[model samples]
Target: MFKSIRWRVTTLYLILIIAALLMFSLTLKGFLEDYFITQLEDNILKETRLVRSLLKDEIVSNKRVKKIDRLVDEYSNEAEARITIIGSEGKVLGDSEQDPLKMENHLQRHEVQQSIKTGVGKSTRYSETLKINMKYLALPVKHSGNIVGVVRLALPLTQVKEALADIFSRVINAGLIAIIISLILGLSLTKRITKPIERMTEVAGEMAQGHLDQRLMVTSDDELGRLSYVFNNMADKLKNKINEISDEKNKIEAVLSSMGDGVIAVDNIGKIILFNPSAENFFEVKEEEIIGKYSLEVTRSHKLDQVVMESLEKGEEVSEEIEILYPEERIIRVKATSIKDQDEQIQGVVVVLRDITELRHLEQVRTEFVGNVSHELRTPLTSIKGYVETLLANDNPDSAIYKRFLNVVKDEADRLEQLIIDLLDLSKIESGISGKGYEAINLNQVIEDVLTIVMPKVSDKELNLKIDVPAELAMISGDESQIKRLYINLIDNAVKYTPNCGEVKVKVYEDDEKIWTEISDTGIGIPSEDLPRIFERFYRVDKARSRNLGGTGLGLSIVKHIIEQHNGMIDVESEVEKGTKFIFYFPKVK
Candidate 1:
């Protein structure tokens, strides 16, 4: 119960009120008691002075001192108090409440002793003569500047005690009434103050629980009411700000989810705070499983860990391309940046990873293409130069030798021209400049035309050629010239790779969704390991044989690009010396 604010406030209020009432009661009681004691002492002192005047001459002799008892009794009756008188010889000459003859020596009395020394004295004590608690006052009776005796007066404190008791009763009664009223008022005020505060506390609790819509009601213009107003306004602002933050957070989440590159965020302690879907896929782990785990434990890549640690240590961005072998082998380009606050204090690290395997492969292909082009161009030029130089050195005007050398130069020139044409065609196809639009072309007719053109080469080699294409095969959507070039390259390659008298066959067919073409040749087949890379530009399985047959080594590569442009797939099957078959599949036009 004490833990409750309302109870505590009420208790505090009660305590303060009780304390004030107690202090006021005590002070007033003390003041009244003092006032009564002072008035009583004053009345006794006046009586004492009156008695001294009455006995001024009588106290000059022992005969007059004998009447001291009578005078004291008279004054004691009038004052309603006990009275005493003492003579010069330290004897009790008279006492209103005791026999003077039987009384003890009076000079030893504290009041009388004090009076002898200072002319007037007062004391309060339990008096032996009066047999009661009394207030005593004494004065020196003087005669012509000579001290004759001491006159002492005392009052029993019975009336003073009764008066003080009366005052105490009234004070206690009034104090009880005041305390009751104070308690009532304190509880009422405490309730009024604490009710709104309690409500605010409840609302604050709700806000802490993420219910920002809770608000306090303002019912007055008092400080508490104004505080409620401010609290409600603050809640409104908080709700709006939280909503804005949530929306922004959702936007960021969406962006991260859809990103092609992997994104990871770690806290200052190097624990994973955010792992996006791309990052999950890149690391082959679920984000939910790895959150709050250390980055090193999650990634298991020392290079990535080092990058993030370095960025955090240096308070700057660090980036590198590192390969990952776990989950899968991949070449990834990672960029790590240190996250910092407005104070320029390092907070965490953010890493972005881009898979660059395909890019690296393309770079390698480009390098190989440059070298192959140099070698291919150099070969024909070297042959032509040697033959020309041979002719020049002979110098004897031998017509037959000159004709043979010129024929050699012309064939080399023609081969070089074909190589340049193939290169140009490949560049155009790869750059999307060629076959930009598709037209319906009959595959059967394209093949027939290509076979007719290459039939002479087939005849020269005495190779048996067969064609098996459906005349009613579905037309495919592609450039007519590109389709013709595609068929011509496949047939030419098959004829060139085949030895003399080897058999070459072409078959074309159509299904419900696709058109297919297969070119089979009994040729020196591609090795099994080279099938994957057989279509790469300037890659020759038998380089010397390809060169002797006037092959530019770009024919298969051109065929591949043309087929890809037409949204077709081409595959090759081969055995070392048995045979090779090239298959093409094209989407059938509806």
Candidate 2:
């Protein structure tokens, strides 16, 4: 059976209460008994003293024995006593309640012998004549300086016994009442101590049942109160710690669930503790089947296990991109990190797998593109260098042909310089290290200035330039020079690439959230497949024609970075050989 705190406390309280009550009852009983006996003895001694005083003269003259006996007999009945007169030899001479003549020698009686030997004695004894317990007191009678006889008196102690019995009854009744009161008080006190503890027990039990928000209330500063205080503190701390852990767990869960990559967590013992949706999908396993199982068994990826173990042994983060071979022979990039504690101990490992198959393909395309750009730029550069070297070897350095060759060298030099500068600018932008000074500027003025600077190029290409900007065009926040550079790069490319009589148009508009601009040109368009990589550094579609037209593949890349620095986005739409359009969104000025 289960015994609760209240019951145990009540039982203990009752035990202690009973023990005390018994002791008090026993002590009262002994004291009352002694009191009763002492009172009886005192009464007996007082009677003997009074009677002996009355017999003093009679005893001294040695006369009136019968008269004295008669007198004793009369008063003894009133006194409620037994009276006896003894001679100096301790022999009974007269008795008030017994026949004096028939009485045996009284010398052996304790009271008579004591009076004879030492002048007085008192005792309690059983009386044969009365057949009851009685108290006896004796006093010596002195005559003419000689002890003549002793007058002894005895009284029945029945009244004293009755009075003591009455007291015992009262004491017993009082003790019973006191015990009852003590029991009530003890139970009440026990309840006080145990009630809170009992509540704590219940709350703790609830906590064990997964109600982690359980708490305790404090009531006093006694031991019980101290216990309660401690209990409440413990509960509060536990609740806070659990809440903290729960919140962190929730945050981690949110991140893992929403991520585009797969995440898996394993404990130090190589057992899987956490696996997100992506991981489950990637591994083709359910979370229920994988959790609490060995990572090797669940993931079947030895590369991941080896990485985790290495990170644990080194007590550091270990990263390795490995292909996880699935049941279908599909591969993925797994990036693993060791989970560490505040003490720098490796507690577990987390692996994030990113599917980069498309990115890998793009990388291959970029490599081929760079090679093509190299070949395209080198052909023109090599031709221009060969023509200039040939012209330099001639004797006539100021002829018309020489002038034409110098012009060609100058054009090629400009083209090469533009290409180098564009590449350098793209590198700076992509690396997030653009050194252009930044400040707020009127976006309209920047647009006007770039258009004016590029008008000559527009005329040279016989292209029509259209500007449709409102007077209230939103002010832009960026480096004014970089903004100009950004516009020039885009406009120059449009004019240079567009066919004669083609239209180069620019438009600006605003919505509640942002200001946007679009630059559309009837120029050579890019293929849909290469549209995504157009903003990549050193990427060009028509590489040979772009080099001949003084094009640097970095123009679009720099534009991307400038927009990014202004916290904007750029999107492009193009049709192969039909037209190209670039859209940029920027935050409106405050």
Candidate 3:
């Protein structure tokens, strides 16, 4: 309830009024007190001066002290106060209420001392003689222009204190009435002023809840009424603006949803403000989770965040490719563009992210394929040209030399032909141009056929080739020729890479829903870092050694493609010096 503006304004007025009253009361009270005391002091000083005139002649003579006493006693009643006469030697020569001889010397009195020094003195203090609060005034009796005696008068302050108390009582009563009246009128005026504001507040709250039609009523032509008029106008404009903004928002949302590339936008301080549905997969989190998070927290890639930060700080566009390892390993190409206002101030950064993992892998494979093909074909071509040119330059040549050169040229031609065949076969398998070949093929039969073809090479290396074939394994859906090529590549790779007398093992088995194959070789083995790209086209662990072994370098890549076509999965494990293993599984045919 205290949070309301009405109560707040009312409380402020109450506090101000109370403060003014307190200050005014204190000031008036102090003025009255000083006025009362000053008037009393002046009246007492005048009486003392009158009494001084009577005693001037009697002060210097001891014989006249009685006369002085008689005179003061008579005037004391008239003045309505006690009176005293003091000699020059500080002796109390006469007193109105007490015997002159019984009274103490007046020398130590503050008022008497002041009168002797300055001709007039006044004081108010508790008096022991009368046992009451008293005001004292003293005057020097000037005779022959010399001070001979001081006449002092004392007055009780009971009446003065009573008058001040009465004045204070009257002021307090009046102040109470004023406070009550002011509270009643002030509250009414405050409510009257705040009523229009309250109506406008209600309308604004309704507008917040999407009821923009709500408006204030203009009750008068005063400031609050005019404010109401402006408020209604603002409500109308706000309603129209909200409609337009909603339409724009819907369009933006539609565009972001349909986009294939992921989009993320952050404010100038790097808190995310916009995250599209497409971006959820890239970060492996829903848009709601990371909408207000930093880019590094969502992408977990510092390189990608650097692009965003650079775009924000420099107000320029930045692009980078970064790798993410969650949900799967992938390469993301991100482009961060600075969002700006009309004045060209950076407001935030918006980033478009494209998943380029496959694209990059494909490009790398294509580049390697082109280089490998050129090297393979160019070497043989250059040799053939060189040999033919030599035979032509020598008008006559030894037959054996010519035949040996011809044989070397033929061997080069064969190598070039083999590389071309492998390349074409891989392309056809990947492109699906020759149509998919689906048939029920036994895994055991395929392995046996591949072993027969690779057995000769296995024997040449003196490697021990072992096979564990289930006599009747499950058949899988695939092409017979493709499956044969897949096994031949796996087995040949195992045999070729194995050192002399190294062990090569092959196993074929089946579970309820699929058939599985395992091929492991105790060869030189592959490095752990090279296992991921081992199935990429033309990727070789040792290029010179692969060429020497007559490897076209497309065998493992082709094997992977054939397996994928058959709806299967393959995995590899390897150590640098121990061995390598290739395990694969194919879905069973219904």
Candidate 4:
């Protein structure tokens, strides 16, 4: 429904041209009509003077007078006029187109009366002789310096009226042609002027609709063309800016998707605007299903939702941890932060989720392990210090108690040495420092070597040993020393924790793809909650008993690291005072 400017301009131009042409044609027609009327009057006065002279020069006897009269009559007929001569008594004489005897009194006529008094006169009036409207010119005839008669010429103005009418007709025709031509030309000019502008307008409209690449084409150097140039430049700049923003957005998306932690972004309206691939995997939801939905509805994480709302309300950044429970009961840690713009206003909130449940357990184990190790090492260290001080103070080198004190010192020293060795092994494994010669090794041989070293301890405890290893078990590929160290730690733990007459069993087997080993003990079994964290360095369930037993608390920690280096898995299950089971699954050598 938008009206084009071209039509509006064309309409205005046509109006102006028609008005000017009409005025000019009317004025010209008026001037031509006036000129023609004036010329006719002058010719009439001249002819009348000649007739008067001819009448005065020879009174009715002269042939020349008749010829003059015939000439006047011929002139009247040719000029389409009537000529008349009036006597001084106001009687008509020598009247053309009328008999002189029947003519009315002419002395009182407007032109005739004026001619008698002023010698010449002219008037336009209805003529009684011709019975039509006429232009009358009169002149007084003079003889011997006195007026003898008046000559009057009345010309019917029909021919002049017709001529003026013809001129007006031509003016009207010309005016009509001029108006028509002006309209045609005006339309063409308007088209040329407005077409390019219209194109620019269309481009602008498209750009407003988010087509930033739209541009105008310049076709001239006029104002419209200059405007087009500016518009095209503006469009180009807008396109570039939009592309830059798109590129930056793509980069941000790539980073978010590539991250190890899941990322989710929410707008001020609490709708999820960005949900990366990691977030989908971490939350066990699809990006399409989550994006554009309310964050609370999608994540069901009230902690994150409240944090985002509070940050938005305060116009500040906020950080917090949110826990999301999976359908399988696995927990994930989501660290959320509110995004802010340069003005320190909250734009949105970003939540990054990491699977830290295992790490949390490990951290807890490390704390417990440190506490147990500190207690275990301090006991021996205190005993050694007290015994050494007593030996140094007493100068009785041969006292019977001196031997007992030295024996006590030796036992504590031995405990301390074992603690130091265990700590060193745990440290090396954690630092991924397996000594040289990493190769494929037989699981059964490794288990046997550990059993041989712990056989003395097992026999001293009167424990029952059971081995259920198969001869055809597949070899596990890893560092030999590390694997042997792994078995030694497992067997030592079993022998240390098991009571006398308790069962200690070792088993080696193979599934289709993996080689597995399990060591179990019938001892003070670990609780289910504590089973998940038993492998952490220096961890002990019973601090007092573990220290009395001289456990360095790093046995299971070293075992866990060695299994990891071998690309294997370790799992433990226990029931308090019933039993404990440890399983190691390693990739079988091809």
TM-score of each: 0.68, 0.49, 0.52, 0.62
**Tens digits of lDDT, candidate 4, 1-590:** 22778878887788788778777867877787779888997888777766666565532322343444565577677656687766667765566676666767878888877887777788888866568889989887766686767777887889888988887888789878887888889879988888888787788889889888777778789898898898888888888998899999999988887888878888877889888897787667998877789977876767767876886677655665456654434356655566778897777877667777778778876787677778778889999999999899888766778899999999899989988888887778778786785787877777778788999999999999999989877777888988888888788888888989999999887889998788899998998888777776666799778877877777787888888887888988788888888988989888
- Among all windows of 10 consecutive residues in model 3, the one with the lowest summed lDDT is 433-442
The CA lDDT at 368 in model 1 is 90
Better of 2 and 4 by lDDT: 2
Give lDDT tens digits, candidate 3, residues 1-590. 77877777777877788889889878987898899888988888788888877667788564677888898899998999899998877888889989898888888799989988887877789988789999999988776787778889998999887998898788789878877887787779888987877777787888899888897878799889888888888888888998999999999999999999999999999999999988887767888877788988887777878899999999998988888786678898889999999999999999999999889988986787788788777877898889888988987899999999888888778878888888899889988855455788877777777888988998889998888988987678878898888888888888888899899999877889988889999988898889989998777999889877878778999999999988999999998777889999999888
Candidates, ranked, TM-score: 1, 4, 3, 2
Global CA lDDT of candidate 2, please?
Answer: 0.80
Report lDDT (Cα) of residue 458, candidate 2.
85
Top candidate on TM-score is: 1
Global CA lDDT computed for model 3: 0.86
Winner by TM-score between candidate 4 and candidate 3: 4
Question: Could you arrange the candidates by lDDT from highest to lowest?
Answer: 1, 3, 2, 4
Query: What clash pairs does model 2 have?
Result: none
**Which sections of candidate 3 miss by over 4 Å?**
1-207, 210-244, 258-272, 277-366, 386-403, 451-466, 497-504, 521-533, 541-545, 573-580
lDDT of 2 at 32: 77
Report, for every candidate in turn, its global Cα lDDT versus the true structure: 0.87, 0.80, 0.86, 0.79
Pairwise TM-score winner, candidates 1 and 4: 1
